[model samples]
Target: MRKPLLMLVLAAALNGLTACASAPSADLGSAPGVKEGSTPSKGSTLIIKDFADRSITFPSAPQKIVALANGEMDIVYALGGTLVGRPTATVPAALQAAQSVEQVGSTHGLDLEKIALLSPDVVLGNHPLNTKDIPGVEGVGSKMVLTSANSIDDIKKQIGLFGQLLQKEDKAKELTQAIDQKLQELKTTPSTAKTRVLMVYGAPGTYMAALNNSLSGDILVSAGGENIAADYPKLDNYPQYAQVNTEKIMKSNPQLIVIMTHGSPEKVKDGFMKEMQQNAAWSSLDAVKNNHIEILPADLFGTNPGTKVVEALDLMSKRLQAAK
Candidate 1:
């Protein structure tokens, strides 16, 4: 799945954060290493930590923070931490209600001065910004936490790491458990049929579906839907724009079609459906005839999985399972 186009897409926000199928529960049996009072001193302000490290030792817990990446912002919210600042236009809609937080320039081309002026005690950044922004972030006297997540396990670990940093271990535990339970719930339920699905990506003049392992493909599998493109497994095509022959789409005869376009919900819906309707071959597909098309929000259906990803699975399951 393509990353959602934040209209004002700030410069190089980190990329390639992937999600995977759930792992065995036994693998997650233990919590991260940290005692209740092990928090960094409130007085000590400087600290640095890497994503791979299992433990973080901060001089003081960060009370005022600026999140420079989406993952960091999500983690902060998951841990119930107060964010004093975040990159503009990068925050998810779920968090748009937070009006008090300051928008320090875009993470990619960050306004160093605005961030510095915040006097943030800690700055959270991912791989893309870690090296470039570290010196400036540190020069401003704030600690910087560098995080990178490539798989679902990494995402879980981040939840725990942020929990420890924000003293919300309990919240972290609860959210993790919820995710684990949802995966388990999906695992045990048998799908009546592996509904063939096509995850159509939309751009100005390009439209295509993803094979397995991409964000959209992962969600389809998690929801018990099979990607019709799985058979044509082609590599070296990222944000691949291979023109999908309409005849091929008809032949695949996907049981359902999901249109994922990035933009405001209203615009994305009107445009994708109108386009789908215009394509003669697409209009002839079983999915289109049956009206089994779902128009998903750009942000939720775009890149990177999180709580909303889990919800997407449930939604797909319920929709796909309904008798046609």
Candidate 2:
């Protein structure tokens, strides 16, 4: 991005920050490792510890950038960084600034050649999903910064990272503070009987439960829903997700079945519903019998919503409240 535009954005953001700063605040908590700009590199280079725990060094701040995930892409644009290339996904309405960015490929199926030709100074991607592309990006002398967002703190960390990268540290602080206040207001209601919810995320054939550590699960818990998959054994390959346990699910007897799909919502939901119908065991669950299943909005829940996190929390809280 040009220095002038960056300056104008930061200046314009002060109005938002001032408005948000007027809100009440409460002390919350945190997580670790990828704190964006936590490390210092040799000489004038900038060193940042990515979510993968790899130290990514860039000579000065990166200008040409590639974003491989919608969430990270959202953060970049929010921080006033324009992308040379981006992944193929629905740009959240709030991130309309990125709607015109060039599409590269999906996270798992990246067009390495196309990305290489863009000659981005740095590439932003999600942990695990985009870590495998480090070689491809590095081969072209570009650095890859990977991050995971399994919780609100993770989202804040992303803002921090992008804010620093875009040279908008003050804006990042204002953003995090605003989010913190909003979250405190959305604190889970204290109830003797919490809503029992089974949070599921995946494509049609391959389904997984969102365990307590995943972002979806975190959102569930934050919204006063008791996650049935909270204590389930984590999958070795995907610690945040677990293999669906029908027996355990039946035993838990959840009141709500919340779904977040990775593909076409209509197709994914149809496939899931078909599976539930074919298997009477799943069909008989209280959540199904009561018709309390809910498929979250794709832009807000399926993947990370980036700066739209507070909105996601508000939506989840309201849904759980109505169900209760």
Candidate 3:
């Protein structure tokens, strides 16, 4: 999953975790088969059932691509591809490939006018967030592929899709294998008896507990951290998160806290800390008093990590183990 861009209006507070009811019976991440490392066959295009399970047909291997989310941008770049345009978000650290791409605006506030002017062949975006954007993208003569990396499986599926789309299956497999190996190594980490964790997503002064459905929460679990917010009812609009409750936090008494935010990390952290101090019980929570709080790297946590997912998982695993 991404911060969502969610870091989603939880748009940015959480980014990439959702299931679309309108999707087809097929897995959203599946793609039409092609030979490994083979070029697109003549007189044909690629097709994929996006994360929403919608059928998306590519007229040809997209030349002028517009990636509407940072995670997507990172993935495209990781596949040895460049972008014609990208959202105005921080690119992941591993995506060192620079492009002279235009800023088409954020995932939530896409500048359609600018997008149309680009005449992109393909537009990649975060699902559910960009499902409504299909019309706008199509209006610009571009086919949109909306996908998200909610879990390790989701990330691998997305990478495979992009690999097929970019004619870079070899690279995609390499990236996916790294994730597999990392996860295998993680299985060997001695269980910490489920280190209690509270993952909060920040937007301005407001914050919500990220639920198990979120990308961050997914990684938290892989790292052996049990999300105390797992049982909380999800927000109708932002299903990946729930309204943060001090009473709930106190009752859970989590052993670790991880905060993910978009802008001004210090301000958001300070605001949360101020709120915690106002309540003696909240301040005395194990995570708080033991200084077990962690602010995940904005590039890797709040948004979808894409090709940087291996690093993201490694970071989360270390965090959980440290708290243990």
Candidate 4:
């Protein structure tokens, strides 16, 4: 009788605390035929929505995990959680080299079979992919969780939350404090002048920038530089080109035009820089006159305005000081 009682208790704990091991799916509503938005409560489970507005809840502290989103990977690393697999997407190089980590699939597509083999306890994804449930992430064997890190504040909160889910709450607090302190330092540094800077994004094939609350634009603001296109007021995708007449850029006439290109900085000159250099209309601009055009990695300007924003601030602050 005592043995049977012990077995029942063990089963209950495993049922509630054990992490799921399967692929993501389209209908991640519930364990069986449940609805979306409503999550079942296991011991210490918590549900939260991310920037992409997807629903996710963790059963117990997950150890073996796979991240389907780069931002998700960013948060995981920041919280000091180990990853079992990741999408073979444009995640930062330093993140990919983690010992024992594997690439299950790319962000554009999912490899259910490959992901299944990894036996992930929890799968992480966000935004565009949040709503689309994959087979491996939501099957009976695996549990799917959505991570929300849309804004800088959201990123900070997710750091704490990930720490809780990974049983590293102390590490989460320390990292969050470090990032906050760095951001404050950047914000407090007095600006000599508002250097007119054009933060060009997108691939050469497509060129664009963020306005208002965009991550890139926010970084520019935090770095003590003024975005030449601040008046645009919208955020779009990579390769989303905004056709500014040469006159518009000339009118903005940034003191220093920073061409931010993805991939190699060398590639920056090949795309928009070369075109701008040869154009007669842009020749009169101050940036062109002084050859103040420079290139930087997309990550320094890309990653959501979280701790990475500090890196952008450091880079931009140095450039602004040099321009003086």
Best by lDDT: 3
Ranking by lDDT: 3, 2, 1, 4
Per-model C-alpha RMSD:
9.1, 11.2, 8.0, 9.3
List residue ranges in candidate 4 displaced over 4 A. 1-49, 52-55, 89-100, 134-136, 148-150, 233-245, 304-307
lDDT of 1 by residue, 1-324 (tens): 123333112221222112212222221334433433444444553232445232334666678988765556766776777788876765677776445678876556666666656778777766554656655555555666666544445566667767767766689888778777877898899657788777776665556666665666666687677777776535454533234556567788887877776555445556666766666677777787787877665555655445455666677677677513
Give per-residue lDDT, candidate 4, residue 106. Answer: 51
Of candidate 1, the 10-residue stretch with the lowest lDDT total is 15-24
Measured with C-alpha atoms, the lDDT of residue 239 in candidate 4 is 26
Runs in model 3 deviating more than 4 A are 1-43
Between candidates 2 and 3, name the one with more favorable lDDT. Answer: 3
Error of 2 at 71 (Å): 0.4
TM-score of each: 0.71, 0.80, 0.85, 0.75
Q: In terms of TM-score, how similar is model 2 to the real structure?
A: 0.80
* Candidate 3 local distance difference test against the native: 0.76
Query: Candidate 3, which ten residues in sequence have the lowest lDDT sum?
Result: 12-21
Q: Going through the candidates in order, what is the number of backbone clashes in each?
A: 4, 0, 21, 16
Which stretch of 10 consecutive residues in model 2 shows the poorest summed lDDT?
20-29
> Which prediction has the highest TM-score against the true structure?
3
lDDT assessment of candidate 1: 0.62
